[model samples]
Target: MKLTELADLYRRMLLIRRAEERLQKLFADGQVPGFLHLSIGQEAVPVGVSSALSDRDTVSSNHRGHGHTLAKGVDLTGFFAEILGKATGLCKGRGGSMHVADLSKGMLGANGIVGAGLPITTGSALAHKMQRQGHVAAVYFGDGALAEGVLHECLNIAKLWSLPILFVCENNGWSEFSPTDRQLATNLEKLGKAFAMKYRSVDGNVIADVAAAAGKLVGPMRRYPAPAILECRTTRVRGHYEGDRQDYRDAGEIAALEARDPIRLAAEALAEAGAAPDLIAGIAAEVDAEIEAAAEAALAAPLPKSADILADVYTPAEV
Candidate 1:
């Protein structure tokens, strides 16, 4: 990867890492409302895939989607505010974290339901193809969604019509509280082949590797307009939700995953690529300051008014 690109990736990955860390603290202190599903150790998937997409390209995200939304260019303040349920949030505090959406940024909102993004992404891809727009739609989901019926149906239809969509499965080994292997026996690559779609898998902790793999698939997806799947083997450092005690995970699992932190790996790659140590430190410092400022602003923002609960829910037709 180019130095500039590597720096950009590192910056984004660090932003995600720091932001989630802050959110964890905030949630612990009773600041954020509702359940929080963090993509703490899965930053590389969104950073890499989004880097390969254009501003016009669209993406759909699942419950653990703060990273995806941020990587797609949602403003930091709005994202934090949304999570904090402030009126100044992306959905005016109505959607909170799971439903955060900014259509202007081509983020089609994060779904709360498993496997929900598949059809939404497929529809967006169909729209792009029908409109002759040289854009693609990428969807982020977990390995658990592989069992959802919608996933296979969407894949079959996407292949039949050659939709310009990328199915990104962030397989973190665990589905909710259970290991994925215990719930499903199918190989993702072989499943992709069943539908005759392009498929690839990579180490989700390595940003450069993920980016390289995403670029190769997403590049041709726009020109030829076909469905593809990129299975990223990742790790989730936190519990399923913020407060759940992780008795299901083996004793050393979390520590072992932390040892391969994506942010640290990216920094090492940057240094190896001739990036100065000061430059790397500066990046982390900048991201930290940014997250802190956003968090402060979000905490101080006003709550949504009770009267406006139904304001943006529907639109009236022109008279």
Candidate 2:
């Protein structure tokens, strides 16, 4: 737990927090189009996992993927622009909130379908396996996505081929409108055993725990391409999104999770390790400014033109 590493983690997590907060505001103000899924409380999983990977490694993220994208070094301006559906976006405004992607940064995209990123990551892992490259593929999804049939199929293929893949399950305990208890028959870790792959379960609320666990898995995957699963038990600070009323949750359950907010936990750990209080404040201020600038820029930016509706969907013949 070096002071510098802890500080950097804190800074990254804060950026996710502030950026999503700004997105929430913009979503409500009608600036951002399409459905939005926020990675508000589960910042540690993405940041921690990404910390262990090289830039060449890739991640396939779920709808709640802003944290994962940012952790993988996606440009904040470009991401915000994509959410705003601006031409300056990574997808050139063709893919909106649910489809923001930057292959250069190794983020596949935030897929709209439940558990769709699993197979995508498995394919990426297979590509790396064929090249015999040291790069690893990580896919982040919620507990909700576990219900998808493709996830199990992908898991089987990755393990069978011993592909370098990390399947991260951000088990926040809800599948959108359905609760995990109702939808899932067994635990996620148990499913890993059926696939005969390496598996780990961690308290995703603590970034340190997540970092340590993630570090342990990264090395093995590179050495011997095998499928691995890390089940992070975390929570969502906001409703599924800004507008979700969260009618399914009890007041007490939300309160309990909020009381154990991971951002606060990380800040406290850093402060105890001799990080200056003002340094933490400075980081917070910096993130706030960056997010605000992105929001303003996105709002003033041009939207995709009606003429370009199907341009990116299929490449036109080179004439």
Candidate 3:
């Protein structure tokens, strides 16, 4: 990787890390509403996959998608404000953390329903194909969705039509306190083979590797327009949602999480690539300051009024 490219990846990963940490505190302090699912350890998957995509391409994300939203270039201040329920936020503060959408950025939105994004991108991929837009559509789902019927249905449809879509699965091996290995009968690669679609797997902690793999897959999908899968083996450093005790988790795995942390891995890679320790520290400090400022600004913003709630609502509240 070029020094500049490595630096960029390092910086983006650091941003996601700090942003999630800040949001966790906000959720704990009662500043954020609704349930919050965080993708703390799995930052590299979105940061890397999105690095290979263009602004025209669309991304549909699952519940644990704050990292994907930020990686897709959503405004940082607006993202924080959105979660904080500020009127200045994306979606006018209606979507909160789970439903953040910036259509202008091709962030189709994050869904609270598991595996909902699969079918969404399947349709969007068809739209891109019929329109000849040459832009791929991708979805970020977890191992929890691996067993969903929608995943199988969308895979069949996308492969049958040769839709330009990337099914990016961040398999952290757990499905809401239970091991996903115990939940699903087959893995994504095997599942892809069942549908006769292409599939690739990468170390999700390695941002550079995921980017290279995603570029190779997304590159062809842009031209020939075919469906493919990229399964990222990752780690979920936090419980399924905020405030959970995570008593079902393995103690050994919990202790080993710090070693496999994505941010730490990226920073170490930057050091091996000749980045000075001070330089890496400076990058982290810069991201921390940015996150703190964004958090403060978001907290200070005004909340959406109840009387004008229908203003941002596109469809009729009573159809």
Candidate 4:
């Protein structure tokens, strides 16, 4: 990889890491409401794939979607404010942690339902294809979402119509509280084959590996009228949430995964490539400062008012 590209990827990964860490702390301290699904360990996928996308390309994310949005260049203050339900939030405090959306940036919002974003992404891809725009849509989901019939339907239609959509599955081995092994019967790649979709699996823990694999697959989908899937085998570095006792996770599993922290891995790669250690340290420090600022801003923002509850609701026009 080029030095410039590597530097950018390293910074992006660091941003996601620091942001998620700050959010986790805020959620645990009761500073934020609603359930918070973290993308702590799975940060590499979004940082890598999104780095390859232009501003025009769209992305639809899952419950664990904060990292995806951040990687897509969504505003930091607004994102933090949104999760805190502040008046200046991305959704103007109307949507909580799970329902954040920013249409201007092509983030179709984070879905609350399993497999919901797939079909939405398919439509975005169709829009691009119909408008003859050289753009693609990427949908990020977990392996558990594969159990949803909508994923299969979306893949089938996308393949049939040859939509410029990329289906990215962050196979972290668990779906909410249930382990993936208990839920999925068949392998995920097999389904992609059934749809005649081009597919590849990558080490989701490494940003370079992810970017290389995603970059390869994105070209073919754009050049032809086809859809593709990249299964990123990643892991969840933390619990499902702050409250869960993590009775499901094996002992030392989190610690072991921490050893493979994507940010650290990338920094090491940069260091080995003769990049200045102080440069990498400075990048990490910048991200840390951003996280701290966002946290303080989120904490100080005013809560949404009750009178504006129905401000966003709209009635249909007369027939």
Per-model TM against the reference? 0.98, 0.97, 0.97, 0.96
Answer with 1 or 4, whichever has the higher lDDT: 1
How does model 2 fare in lDDT?
Answer: 0.88
Q: Which regions in candidate 3 have their CA more than 4 angstroms from the true location?
A: 315-319
**How does candidate 1 score on lDDT?**
0.93
Return the candidate ranking by lDDT, descending.
1, 3, 2, 4
Report lDDT per candidate. 0.93, 0.88, 0.91, 0.87
Residue-pair clashes per prediction, in order, are: 0, 1, 0, 1
Best by TM-score: 1
Candidate 4: segments with Cα more than 4 A from true spot: 315-319
| Candidate 1 per-residue C-alpha lDDT over 130-222 given as tens digits, one digit per residue, 9 for 90 to 100 | 988789999999999998999999999999999999999999988899998988879688899899989999999999999999999999887
Candidate 2 C-alpha lDDT tens digits along 105-181:
88889888889999999999999888887889999989988888998899889988999999999999888866788
Off by over 4 Å in 2: none
List candidate 1 segments past 4 Å from native: none
- Candidate 4, position 248, lDDT: 77
Looking at candidate 2, the ten consecutive residues that score lowest on lDDT are: 308-317
Query: By summed lDDT, which 10 consecutive residues of candidate 1 come out lowest?
Result: 309-318
Return the clash pairs for model 2, or none.
162-225
